[model samples]
Target: MLAQIAEKASDPAGRKIHPREVERVFGALLASSEFWRVVALSRLPVETVAEIIKALIDVGLAVQENGALRLTPGGNARARARGIVPLIERTCPGCTGRGIDLRPYAELLDQFKELVQNRPNAILEYDQGYVTPETTVARLALLAAKGDLQDKELIILGDDDLVSIAAALSGLPRRVVVLEIDPRLTDFIQTLAGTHHLAIEVYRQDLRRRLPAELCRQFDTFLTDPPETIPALELFLTRGLAALKGPCCAGYFGLTYAESSLAEWLTIQQILAGKLKVVVTDIIHNFNEYVNWDYLLESVRKDLSFVQVSPRANWYFSSMYRIETLADYDQENRDRENLALYPGENLS
Candidate 1:
């Protein structure tokens, strides 16, 4: 029954959550063990574990004492009724998560790597970064595998990885629009589009200001790689959410656990679930690989010993999250146009 409750349960953000999102929360808990539950919820944009705990309690399947959960007599019965495996099941050998397998898109991934040398490198000031070329194509492969490609209009909030050009090269998506703060990135994208004759449009926008009026509710999907901090994630996610057209729309972005801990992930979940009314459909782990960011030390911070050199091995990793709009997009908040995400940046 879509997990419809008599009294609406709200997230920590104090905003009402969709029943559909609540249902997914329960499904995740049933599908994985406690350890995996912690891992799975980190990828989703909702305070999902709390909801699952509440559901178990409400149904008389579980109880809590001393901040720990205890399954009741009905807990086993409930698990049986739900057909939840008593223990963890073998993860799908392909996508590895509940999402579909994307290994078949090797051709696109290979094409993406071929274009890597020409792609832009990391720009430190703007926090601009690039993931490995293979991971870039992996993101697109998942998108296409999920049926998000093949003539959909997609927007990129920030494309430092330059996935937009790779997407355009696929000849699958209908439109590839971008909003980037770096003039260099925009110019490069434009140059690539001109050279390749791909229909990619690049717009120079400093997200410190409000998004363009025409961008609101204009695209089928959005993809972004925001700064790892919570505030930055909120701003990037908000802009992308506002740009999406309807409930059926989707967005893809990445978050690194190395930079953001579990608590930070929960805050992002609160924004997506409680505020934006979205549900995460897929979470592909370790999807993006970043080159070393420590090169700046060699150029500028010569004062310190160069003992810790820039890592040759690809170390930074980000999980790809595919979240879909569950209810209506937040129009009222969009109209206000005041951003609270980053104090360091100038606000509109």
Candidate 2:
């Protein structure tokens, strides 16, 4: 009977208790007939036991109906979810007992706290105020539904960056190959892959140099978020284009006023003119207000010509852009009709 009790004590969904918490609670349960007796044996006040019961209900373990504690349907399934009970005993170093911990990035943590303190509803990070991580994933789903990534070999350049991380986690591709300049970053990703049992390949290579011949024309889609510099952007665009099997989609942070920004966009247009077509152009708005509006507006004015040719262009003055293409073209009017319908919005 003790052995059966022991086995039941460790059952994940059954009791839904951590090993240590289980030992304590089970001891109490064995000592008393009434629920309050279990609380006394555990040395917790009656109020605390009530709270624990509430938590158990929230996790769908125990349900209270007609003043009786009963196991939920999920509670029965939890007993079958092997190893979960053991996992409860293991605490996350980053969070300790708390659900979230921001001490590692103390500076950013403080900034985030201050930003959200007054305007709790404000959206921050990659997407503008209106866009969310779920929305971004939904958009990727739309792309998938439209066959934008059908049987495509995808090469994700720059894994150490934020965009690369987002792309890695998005899981919206047939296959993904990541190229990162930093060995440490590659190692980190490798560790993460092992931890999550994910099948992702990470290669250590500087994207500034010419891509390996084996990689040339090996991928149908090239996704990059290179450093925000004329030289770096040019290297990624030119070299990335050279490595593509066909037209691809790329995203970048654009500034409207910077001469370097205009030069980089124009250089990309010139380099990809014969081989790639610009299919989609979108600007992402920054919810955290980290975007440079003045620079974005000025850059847009300087490169209005390229903007005119893009099929779809969105003004997220301080956000990012998703540019797609077909085979190269000098002046394809396929997207021109759509472009005329929605003239660029003024960022001023």
Candidate 3:
């Protein structure tokens, strides 16, 4: 059955993907012939989905036809026998699944696109990738809608996406600060802030070192797109928590099922609640779409030889999380001397 194939479908690390994920991949193929659509529908990491597809092909259940997946006649019969069918598209088309419209923020999006036209390309060393211009503005719109942006002091832990600039452009936040390790990004943000006369500060600081004392307990809100590893998430979030001005403050970060598993997510949620003492208010799936990076073939794809079909579209994605501190506990917990507690902790 599908369970057997799921067991056989292992990642390069030799870990077996959950059987339910295998079924989800099968159901995704039944819904769409496009490969990237299958990835989106599966809601699994790209590498995991690719492994499932390879397993399906080995079992004669699926095949690649022109960069897309097709269910074999046997596979179709088996899926029908199991009562698995295509999922209905219930998400709002107008909002593009973000549950929020972009029409109201069209002007900001236009301005953002113009400003970032010459932004630095994603460097492999930084594990750098950015969301679309529209996504950046949409994130701002979400913050504004939630009453987190008006006259708020915001700190962005990393600026590969240049969210600091977008926040400045909105002219809503009281002040914006960026702590970026990349001199190129820090320099670019400083130049833009001066030219635009925006109330923004840019600093070049590696997050691995202790956060500057002056920056701690200074912001109303913080945002980061940390690497998906547990240690990286802990570090970024801990630093973010350290930057907040005590209770009722909020933080936003991104996590993906692509590189992380549900079990891993459960652990992360536990850390947010038990360690960081933040209550997760909202988790919007597919809320953040990353532009495909140029280093994939050299980096992510090197170990994913089973991923035969090259991506034709930008399919990488992560869910946006809004977490709020209920008490001063987070501030106390994150006030640590060493945020990097593990070996080789890299978020890029």
Candidate 4:
């Protein structure tokens, strides 16, 4: 049956009817509650999912049952054959907890991609990884939609993703500043800022150092893609928090379970909830995609060698954490011992 379906479609992979796609499409359905016959989609790119839905229906893997998509017996078999049977076993890190279709953002993706085409990928030693261009725009668009971005002062703690460029291009935020450890990124961003005449300021500052007085408490929102380790997350996140404008100010950071263990996440969460006293407003699941990180990630995951073919999936996903300050917050007074979290070694 699979053979026959493959023969009919010249672009089977293009249609999302291929093996890899089943997990995403069927998995979304499986995760939805029984009462919700019509489930909205998230995580997967919208364009690809459209073709997937059509193909699923055609192959009887999906059917219109009471104005909702219901998997047929054949669909169940296909899911199992694809090793996606226990769909909920490994919960979707992307939309694991939060649910609302991101379909509306789909329309603006290509335009966003065109805007950021010139930007480079992540650097491993810098502990940097970036989301897809569309995902970056989607994030800014989502923030704008949430009334968080318009004419707001934004400071990006680290922008390997170059999201500040997208924000500046959108002209939604009044000002965008980036504090990047990588000199290459600072120079490149400065070049782009000059070319596009975007209101972006770049500073080369290692996280281990004290933040500039100009940056302290100067922003309405802070965005960062920091290191995932406990000490690193603390140092980077605190720097981001320091850049925010007092109470009710927001901060956005991306963290991944693939790299950081549950204990690491808990300790970090406790810092935000206990010591930091900021309310975690939202955890947008699997919001960032790092396509170029495979070469860097293989060192950590060690599972990449098993893939005989280049991976087509966006397996490296990050949850976007939005924290809003509830009260007046003081910056951490970290001495020399605590400075080891930064990329470089400590000196005498």
Candidate 5:
């Protein structure tokens, strides 16, 4: 019998046997009376033996039919082909024993650790939860389309996170320069560009400080997702505006509470009103948590007055600028309000 088994194992066809065949062989071996007698004599628990049989079935080596476990034809062939007994085991219980899903933020962080180092630490410091790349990309695309970013020079005020990376990937701007405060982050960004072969200029300068001379009046588009604080807001919007060539497009977070944050967004609008028209106003919500329409509309009203002004500084506020709330993404309503605020094909 041993010689016959050796001959069968030596066959090239057996070596190429399918996995299913091996599973059946295990099932048949376990179901044999001789094997059961040995298992009982060895004092092995019935539950343990049953568990092993179940594992064989789970791995597709054995099948149960008419209350009898048996080796499938393919399982027998696979065992002979492999010239070894296959050990089937139960699937791992932790994490469902399945691999991680690569589509979410957690998986991306794992895969691109070098790009997003110390992710948990950074997130905890920011007190902001993670967002999926898909959601981030979709929102950015919407913003770009609304702002008419194509054929425009964009000035990004921060580069520590995925937003800067997304902007580089979008290729929506004619020229893109990222201004960041941390030198370490700046170095990381440079290394990121080199590793990914992306063309992006990174500047290691504080927003509170005067912008580099080369950046003055050089940007047509502006994107700001600044830190949610009074000092940071003032520095980024006020100082950063100096770099914009105008007409400019920008977005700011409108907090429901804290008059200071609301005031800061308005302050940015006021500054931009002097040069660029507030062409589009979008409110990106923090998930479905809350809406700050009151704060948003207040800022819009103030900014519109400036946009409606005439070329002359004195005549600008005389005529009321028709400030219309264009679009709002409210997670609570599960609906987006898209209103045409201004007339003309250009605004469309």
Candidate 6:
């Protein structure tokens, strides 16, 4: 059964389908019948999960009913015979699996919510979607827990999530600077900062270009939620690394298995340890829950007839990574070429 599914699910881009991930897909089905729930629980890309589901249905192991997946009696028996079972819900309820409680930051959450109540809606061109305001506060809580917030000069590469505002509200970071391509976000953040007297600076900068000279090696911490493309991974991480003051300075970013495969995850992990010379201190799974983007209604995927269901909930999420520099890296000497620019291919 597994081999049949694996053969059918072989990625055209050559992404290997790991047996553990297949087990996870089965485990996710055992845990939930909703299609999106399975995608979220399996911690795989929605596209990959969709292919796996199609394969499962073709193999007569699973059936789709009203956007839910159900295993046949034979399939259920086979799963149990293979010792597969539902995932135990061991995460802390209060923290929502973030392992750090948000109760302590109640005031911060309140301020963040109120401030972003009329925040700019996400735009498709930028691949932008902001996390729920509470998720923003939770991210700030994690940063504070790691001692990366208070009295630290922070730089935010992208501000659609408006993390700069939340960090400023904490009255912790020594300074907050945002380099955002979206004028709507920049204007909104600047207005809020001026009205609230927050020490935040906004610049209309694009990450595709070089970092500003003055901003290089000037920050204590950096925050960004970059796109999952490999070029994006290198550009965002390298730029963030370049902005840090020295070793011990930290950077926080989000990556999702939905858009990035485990193979891509390996590449990112290698980049962090090898080229960037950073030590990964923490990786909190499902740490950021994005508000459903409005763009999905007209997205190409939404029109695909083969997909039996569409996302009914804010199921898109990403794991947060905190990396600290192992040694002072020469930002000027960093290599930009040879990064993966496409599926299974490295750029020259």
| lDDT (CA) per prediction | 0.67, 0.42, 0.82, 0.66, 0.43, 0.82
Error of 2 at 141 (Å): 5.3
lDDT of 5: 0.43
Q: Over the stretch 224-302, how does candidate 2's per-residue lDDT look in tens digits?
A: 5454444445556555555566554443333322112233456655544433445445444221112112222233323
Which tens-of-lDDT digit does each residue in 1-348 have in candidate 4? 444444433342243245454456576656542212111232443233434555667777766553345578888877777666434435455543335345555545664576567766666667666777767776786677667799899888888888888888777898889888888789888987897687888899887887888878788988877777777777777888877878988888887755554456788889988877788888877667666564543443232122222333455677888888876675663433445654454654
Query: CA lDDT of 34 in candidate 2?
Result: 39
TM-scores across all candidates? 0.65, 0.40, 0.91, 0.68, 0.42, 0.91
> Per model, how many backbone clashes are there?
1, 13, 2, 0, 11, 1
- Overall local distance difference test of candidate 1: 0.67
- Model 6 CA deviation exceeding 4 Å by range: 297-308, 333-348
Clashing pairs in 1: 45-269
Query: Candidate 2 regions off by >4 Å?
Result: 1-146, 162-171, 247-318, 329-348
Candidate 4 ranges beyond 4 A from true positions: 1-84, 88-111, 301-310, 333-338, 342-348
Candidate 1's residue-wise lDDT over 1-348, tens digit each?
334431345444444556545444445445432422332443433234454456556767656553334456676565556554433435565654435445666776776666556765676667766876666676777788777877899999888888898899889899999999888889988987897788998999876566788887888889999977776787788888878888888999898664565567788888888887789887767777676664434433232122123333554567789999866766432433454443255657
What lDDT would candidate 2 get against the real structure?
Answer: 0.42
**Per-residue C-alpha lDDT of model 5 across residues 184-220, encoded as one tens digit per residue:** 5677777777787667788887554567778876775
With a 3 Å backbone cut-off (N, CA, C), the pairs that clash in candidate 6 are: 45-258
Model 3 spans with C-alpha error above 4 angstroms: 11-16, 65-67, 302-306, 332-348
Q: For candidate 6, lDDT tens digit of each residue in 1-348?
A: 676687778664677776677778888889877777787888888777777877777788888776568888877987898899985557678888898888889998888888888888998777788898888889888888999988889999998999999999999889999999889999999999999988899999777667878898899999989867867877888889889999889999999977888888999988887777788899999899999886654653553233545667887889999998866563653444454433344446
